[model samples]
Each structure stands twice: as C-alpha cells, then as structure tokens.
Target: MTANAFMSISLDPPLIAISIAEKARMLGKIQASGRFAVSVLASGKDKIAWHFAGKPNPELHGLFDSLDGLPVVRGALATFSAEVRDEILAGDHTIFVGHVRALNWDSNADPLLFFKGKFGALEDTRKAPAGMLQIETELMW
Candidate 1:
C-alpha cells in the first residue's frame, strides 16, 4: 500500500493533482478543508502505508500532524503542502488539483516504491544498468 504518491503540479502556472476515491472519507475532508499535504512515504514505512490503506490498525489514529497549518503525515521521505486549486471529476475518481505552497524532504531518507501491487524501496546507491534503450514513435511521422 506504500505507493509513491507523485503529487506534483507544473511550476510555470503551479498545479498539483491527487487522485482519491469518491467514497473515501478523506475526500470529503479534503474538499471541505480545501487543503491537504502529500507525505511521500519513506523506505521502511510499509506498515504505515498498509495502515492508511485501511488494512486495520487499532492504535493508529491521528498519526499525522499539521505542517504549516496543513495536515501531513510525519516521517515521510518528503512532504508537500498545497492548497486546492481545482477539482476534476474523473469517473469513479476525483482528481484534486492544488497549488503547491511549501515543500521539504529528509536528506537521508529513501523513497518507498509501489509497483504491481507490492511495496519496495529505491536503491539510492545503485546506478541504472548500462546500455539502456528507449524508443518512441510518432504517428504524425
């Protein structure tokens, strides 16, 4: 459940997007409050992710705190405080786009990665294997 929430907006005009289920309780809070902070989970925080994912936790209420007056989870690899700028209805998900106002990151913290329904960490010291190739095709061409 500890997935990389790549919550970011363009800097030119400044925008952010956070996708949430329409039935989620947090969605109401976010919409009513008009503000929310994205806390990027750090490595070793898989338990926290699972807890937030609603897997069941008895003692995990109010685990996050307010950052710059915005709600944020602590011990994140990084955190971004944003204000709601726009909301777009996308089928069963609502994309909450915001304007980033503040940001911070832990120097020694490693990012938690989520892929194919599993949690993992990025190896900071490992370099991309040599001889990588990518190809893009344009239909116009």
Candidate 2:
C-alpha cells in the first residue's frame, strides 16, 4: 500500500516505523510475513503511487525490483527492507517498528511529494550532477 505515514526511528540499529490502519489488510500481511519494504517513489511516478493507492492501473503493474529478496518499486529514489521488531497499538492505527535489513538509494531522481492533498516535486536548484548536496559552511551572508 502507498503510505505517507512512515519515518526513520533510529540510526544506531537502523530502525524505521510505518503506521497502518488497524483494519488494513496490509497490516496482517506485514504481521504474518514479519517484514516489509518501503519504496520512496521518484517524481513523475504518480501513476505507480496511485496504482498502489488502490487505483490499480494494470499498465503500471509489475514494476518492481528486489532488495534483499523483497520487492521494491523500480526506479524509486530509495528503498528500504526491514524485519518487524515491535508493534504498538495507537487508537485506530498500528505502528510497526522494524530493523532495517537493506537500504538503497539514488540521488539522481527527484522525490515525489504529497502535500496538502496534492502531489508535487521539489524545485531542483542544484546545477551539478544529481548527488549529495554539499554544505558550504564557509559561505557567509
């Protein structure tokens, strides 16, 4: 399922958390499998996102690459596979905390963002190659 409610929980042990509705089918799938993967879609991948969001575009299906033997969206900006470490009940949602097993990323692609109920992309201001943004601490205002 396409989700926006996820975050990095820790760095030391490489943990991440994702929240799913208590009644969501994916919840049981995760619980049974004891693992899950997150793929941060790149910009222009709205159709893929929408497909996973229950829209079901047949043309966008099967666009997955594997990480640690788990499926991740192809061409994703980043992918993370994890094994469930803990689960918490939060009202109508369940938060699953996982220990990251594998992580991969490509800085060349812009990220797909959902804000205020709309999909968008960040303005690319860097003129150089798509890579880590270097901080110039020496530059002054």
Candidate 3:
C-alpha cells in the first residue's frame, strides 16, 4: 500500500511506525507475515504511489525489487524492511511499530512527497559547500 502515515519512532534501536486502518487489507498481511517493508519513493513516481493507493495502474505492475526477500519499489530513493515488534490501537488505525532489520538508500535521489493532496519534490535550499550540491545531483535520475 502507498502509506502516508509513517513516522520515525526512534533511532537508538532503529525503530519506525506505520499506521494502517483497522479494515485495510494490508493490516492483516502485516499481522500474518510479522514483517513489512517501506519504500520511500523517488521524485516523479506519483503514479506508482497512486497505483498502490488502490487505483489500478496496469502500467506499474511488476515494479518491485526485493531486499532481504521483502518487496520494495525498483527505483525507490530508500527502502526499509522491518520485523513487526509492537502494535498500538489508535482510533480507527493500528500503529505498527517495527524494528528495522535492513535499510538502503540513495543519498542523491530526491524524495517524493505528498502534500495537500498532491505529489511534490523538495527544494534543495541548504547552504552547502559549492561542489557538494553538484556532487549529490550528479547521480540523481
């Protein structure tokens, strides 16, 4: 599923959380498998996100690669696989706390962001060393 309800819970033990609605199909899948993976989509991949959000986009089928045997978006900016460690009931959603088992990222790729019902990319406004900015963008696709 294309989840927007994810957050970092801790760094000491490398934990994260994703909120899934009680009735969501993914909830049971996570419960049964006791694991879940998150793919931080790269800029220009809104179609992939929309596809997973329940609107079928046949063009995006088979767009997954595997990490530690868990599915992740093929060109994601970052990916994380985790073991379900705890669950918290919150209103109509259950927050699944996960202990991160493995992770990989491309520091050069800009992240995809959903905001105000639209997808967008972040602006690089950091005041970094002149060559540093160019180096990061060199590998972005």
Q: Candidates' TM-scores? A: 0.77, 0.85, 0.86
lDDT of the structure predicted as candidate 1: 0.78
What is candidate 2's CA lDDT for residue 55? Answer: 89
Put down candidate 1 lDDT per residue, 1-141, tens digits, no spaces. 222345656986677788887788878988999987888888887778888787877866666867778767777888888888888989987888888888888999888778898889876586556897556878883
How far is each candidate from the true structure, as Cα RMSD in Å? 9.9, 6.9, 4.9
- Which predicted model would earn the best TM-score? 3
Pairs of colliding residues, candidate 1: 9-15
Task: State the lDDT of candidate 3 residue by residue for 1-141, as single tens digits.
Answer: 889988899998999999999999999999999999999999999999999999988776679899878999998999999999998999999999999999999999999999999999999786877666444345656
Candidate 3 Cα misplacement greater than 4 A, ranges: 125-141
- Scored by lDDT, model 3 comes in at 0.92
lDDT of each: 0.78, 0.92, 0.92
